[model samples]
Target: MIFNSDTSSDQVQSEFKGRVSLLESDVKQKNCSIIINDLKEWDSGTYQLRVITLPRAGSSVWGKRSCPLRGYCNTLVEGEISAEAGLCVVIPCSFTVPDRIQISHIVWFKCESTKWRCDHGDMIFNSDTSSDQVQSEFKGRVSLLESDVNQKNCSIIINDLKESDSGEYQLRVIGLQMEDALTFSQKATVAVKGLSQRPTVMIPTLTEGQQTTLTCTAPGLCSGSEPTFTWRWRRRGESDTDLTGNITAVKTENVASFAKRSSSTLSFSPSAEHHGTNITCTVLFQGNVSTEETATLNVTYVKEVRITQNASVSEGETLNLTCKVDSFPPSLITWTKVSDHSSRNGTGTTLQNNTFSDSAQLREERGTATLSLFNVTAGDAGQYVCTVTHMNSTWKENVNVTVIYMRDPVITGNLRVKEGAVLNLTCRDNSFPPSHVAWTQVFDQSSRNGAGTTLQKNTFTTGDYLENLRFLVVALLLLMIISVIVVNLRYWRKSVQQGPTNTKSPSGFSNEPESLQDYDDVSNATARAPTSPNLLDDHTSEGEVEMNFPQVRFTATPRRQTTNRDSSSSHQDES
Candidate 1:
């Protein structure tokens, strides 16, 4: 120790002796160390150390000064650092290093784990190695201020923040003092926001009857807590429904930014029932705060068409047909009727046409269209088609229309016949899809019966050729019978006109018709009427009749043979 030159040599020796201990005091190699023991709070201020070295060749003694000893190691003051999920953040810190120490490297680490504890709790950075071993979660997301690193600036700016980044972080300064390397720690806390950013839901073009998948991405890439995703959809004319989805945890980094992106996906098959609906995806974060996104689903689909109308309509009746099409947006519909008909113009010449013209009226509404045919007739019978146009597809449906009618029954047969003659009669009707036919007799209610088929036309009793001949013969025989009766009556009346009286002649015989009374008794035989003979046994007999005339001699076999006093001169009988 060197003191003032005026001080007493004994006093300087006495003050230095046993008052200080110099450790490893090798002057040849320029080694200097000093230690103060039993320090008190009162010793807190700056205290400097001085060393003197002498060369082996008696070089001039050189002196150097050491840094002031502080109360503790270098310190870094840090408050809470706040950041958004997709943005960035900066943690400001500084430290005081002893002047003799040399800085070699800087390091940053994070610790908030429960599973497998990371070495150094996830290495954020290491300045010594350009590409240091970093945790998979923090790689490329951390950076140190290049200009301020050498100036004891331990502050770092981390980009691409995520919910998982919310935790305590400590910075380490690795450096060499003399030949030994040392490390110092400064801890800071980070608070990342999961609700600052909203989720984004993407909508894709959907088709009917097609299987599709949709995706919804949440705000933060990763989360401090596993976030929950819920999906809901509003169907047409139905209540809201919850859908189950698959979740994904993604962590990524690049030169521009680094963050975690969590997403959910839904798969389903769509049809017309799902048209015009809203889909919502909600993300529940660590706290009560949540993020939600909604998108309208515009499903491209076409439902099967349905036609409402009567299948069978009568002729001359109005035909009303309706076609319905359910689909997204709206559909275009057309009604067309087809038929085969010929038309005549002013020149009275027939024009050949197979398809009907535009004579019917068409009406349309929301998803349906109607075709009206006014006062329809047989000419309007054919197939009608409804063509539906939707998106890029076209569909057609056909409906058949038939016109039918029944004409009046026509009688075309003999109306009258003589007795014992066959009568033929026939009834017919011209009809489409025919009608039932039957026969009826005027006198007999039990004779009428329904007999015949739906055939368009029918004939009755045409095969009986002998029926006509029987009719003619009966007509001629009736004339012959009238002549024979007239001749007999005339002869009897001439004989009565002679005015003869009953008298007795030779042989005691009465020649005056055997007395008028006796003649009356002989002529009193039961009167027999003239009757025609049965001509055809095979022919059907509708009815029969009999006549009584005993004096006429018209019966081929008389009921009483040889009455007393009967004349046998009339051998020729009524035909």
Candidate 2:
């Protein structure tokens, strides 16, 4: 059977004229040609073609020989193809010839692997090969791969080829010749795979206060694509900035492998400000995918400051001032006196005796500035300012000073006093600032309460006799009474020792008998006189001659002794 490109199998017999009246068997085109340029797994299926034919006659003129005869002519042809995994293959197909025959229909089929059977659409026909005869998995993807359907080049291309496409493919063709009906079997296979995976980025360590360089390397074989590298820096309050670097690629034999490495160099004299800032490197691959790495920057800086001096001060006084600040470069120091005072401006005098030093040592090596003024006077005192310079910045501190004279404390009143006397001593001194008042005494070693006695009442009593006259007088009176009693006793004893007879004797008294004799003579004379007077008167008369003798005797009579003597004498004279 010969199939026309534009004709259908149902009208095939009338459209063709032949000697043999072709009776085309009604056979579905089980296999159809799948023409695919960009073949895929979905393009896999079975296909077929169909044809029909009719009888032909010849006639002769004038005497005759024209005859025509025909029998029913019919045919059917079928074939099968298959596919594999991960590969692209074609389905093989062909057709038989027919005289006065027109092949019009082609069809294809996929036998169910489990049932080993086919359905209606599986038995494809040419006119409706465009119909939903193919399996759902192979519907839109399967197509006619060849240019001419009449030639029966039923080869096809399948792509994105997968394992599931591996199956039996059958083809069926309908035509007029009875002997043209045949089935040829063959199979093909296809395969598919996944793409390559992405790669990782590597980074290095960075130190503070130095230049740091970071590189981001693209991972995997970047066959036909260029790896793009970029860097970003993100800090606390700052926006991100792109970091650029030099990029390069590596290759091996036929496979040109890509390695995208970018380096960003941050050259800075690090400071504390740079700390905790995030520096990152981002690498973009094939414009869609990216890899990144981040690092924290650490910066260091030294402390710094500045100092300045104040203007105008007095003389002869101390000025204390300071200059302080904060920074990184360890502040430098310098001193200058500002002489703006009206008194010192025209005068050729300068008050620059101020000294400078540091007091507190900063633990971070930070310290305090101290300005000292000694023996300051009105001219020496004014505005003294301290200046400190650090990190290109200058700071100044000022102090106003006025100098006044001071005097030592002077003792005003007497400080010495007797033990119990009231002490009133005053100490006074002259000074710019008044001096303090105080009282102190030089202590006496013998006094328990110290040398100076406070102002208070005092009474003294003397135990010495001379000190108390009444006591002395009483002692003298007792001595006088003792002496009087002693004198009286001695005199009484002397009186008792003398006798009373010795007390009566007279010094002129003599123990003589003259007075007694005189008295006795007188008494004798009186007795004699009485006797003699009478005798005498008689004898005197009788004898003058006897008178002599008698006179002796008369005398004896008056002074008996004398008279007797006289009488004895007279008598002796008479004898």
Candidate 3:
């Protein structure tokens, strides 16, 4: 037992010595400690350790001089950490060691990784380094709360903390043992955020002709400078306009933290024009820091519907129809062909016409609805109604599509005619606007007048008449052969009685060929015109018949009437 110091062992057992014990004095395994229940000021002293001697390999090596107990152990006291934002967060840090820590200078560094050690510095503060060595932004900002770092009070203070200055910070005592560096322990983390780090915007559904309110709250959660709020609107095709006149602004504080936050509410009657317009809330912070949040308004309304389609559509062609709907919050649009039977009913409107509704082919994009009718027939051509139902409003528009079709030109008339007959031909076609018709011979490719004598004149030609003459000539020649045969068959004795020489031709011996007018069956030239100018030339192709004075008939009576002829004995040769 050791007593309070009164000059050492002389008083070791003498005065009030009840508080000391050498409980673990066994030197064999080198275990020796002096336990103190409650520390007092007088207990801080060095005492001699005495034990029986033995070799290290033997029992009770407890007494070995080499294992004598002294202060050679290490210990530390670690403190808990807590931090705040927008305000400087102080992390109380203090540490103690069994051995006196010799430090040259204090250095503060910031690093995200705090494993094992923090050697390289984003050095924030260095007590011994030149002022230039510290980052300019942190030069005067970082400091120690306690001037005497040797006292192991490692607390620090950072003024005017920024959100960027949030993270783990490590303090290093340059001269401390490598294992004793504060970087070896879990680092203190600081988090700095604006009282309201992010702006809050609340917008609700707006309907046309209705009053609505939009609220915007600038960022912050704790007490501090209130931010200035401004409201603006951006409509398509229009410049941005400030809306502060309709906006009411008020400063609010969080009851728990006494943190200040700003809020602004805008009141307005919404119209269709305001639909899809951007409402921007800009918060101006201290130091000219500004941020903005934008929200688009969706106002619902419906207006007149515009329907469009091709005026002229070909039969069996696909019909393309577009219905433009001017409404916010796009609504359903149905395209239906209006029926002739469409009538008003008590329940609703119903179409009764022979209408084909292609509801499946309806497609809507943006505010326009498109419908396609496939393989349209002539019946498909009619009035198409585009009905738009948006919110509680309905709009309708009608489009008419006409199917155009045509038939080819058709020619019809008498095609068969006699060789010399007039060729009466006609061409006809049925069309919406009358079509041009013409008659042309397939062989000559000649066009004829529509309905006039001029066309008859063009076809009335001699070539056809000449062909008729060819037939007539053949028929007359056959008749002449028959007549000669008949003349040869009939023979009778005759006596000639001459009155005078009168063959002197009735017209003085004609030499020209006898005109075919003798046939009388031929076409009369005076009745119509000459079949052709060459008709005369064709009739004159035969040699002319000549007439001469008949041999002078003697005045003598018929003397030889019966001379050479006995009845039926001698043939009568009149040659």
TM-score pick, better of 2 and 3: 3
lDDT tens per residue, model 1, 1-575: 42222234455444334434332232322223333333347546564555443353422343121122351144342345566665455665555565666677767778763422324647787665565477776666666656445587666666556788888766555556444333343356688865455666666678877777777766533323445777888876777785433233332222222224466777777666566778888877543567788788888877889999875677777888899998876898877655443212212211112233455566779889877776777766777777899978899888887767677889988898899999877778877677766653332322344333322222323333367778779878876875565444333432332323324345333344422232233323233322345321233222221323432322121123354214321322211
- lDDT values of the candidates? 0.56, 0.41, 0.54
List, in order, the clash count of every candidate structure. Answer: 9, 106, 11
TM-scores of the candidates are 0.42, 0.22, 0.38
In terms of lDDT, which candidate is strongest?
A: 1
How are the candidates ranked when ordered by lDDT, highest leading?
A: 1, 3, 2
* lDDT per residue as tens, model 2, 271-291: 455556776655554325455
Candidate 3: regions farther than 4 A off: 1-196, 235-240, 243-245, 251-254, 271-274, 287-290, 312-318, 342-363, 373-377, 400-575
Q: Which numbered prediction scores highest in TM-score against the true structure?
A: 1
Total clashes in model 1, counting residue pairs 3 or more apart in sequence or in different chains:
9
lDDT of 2 at 19: 18
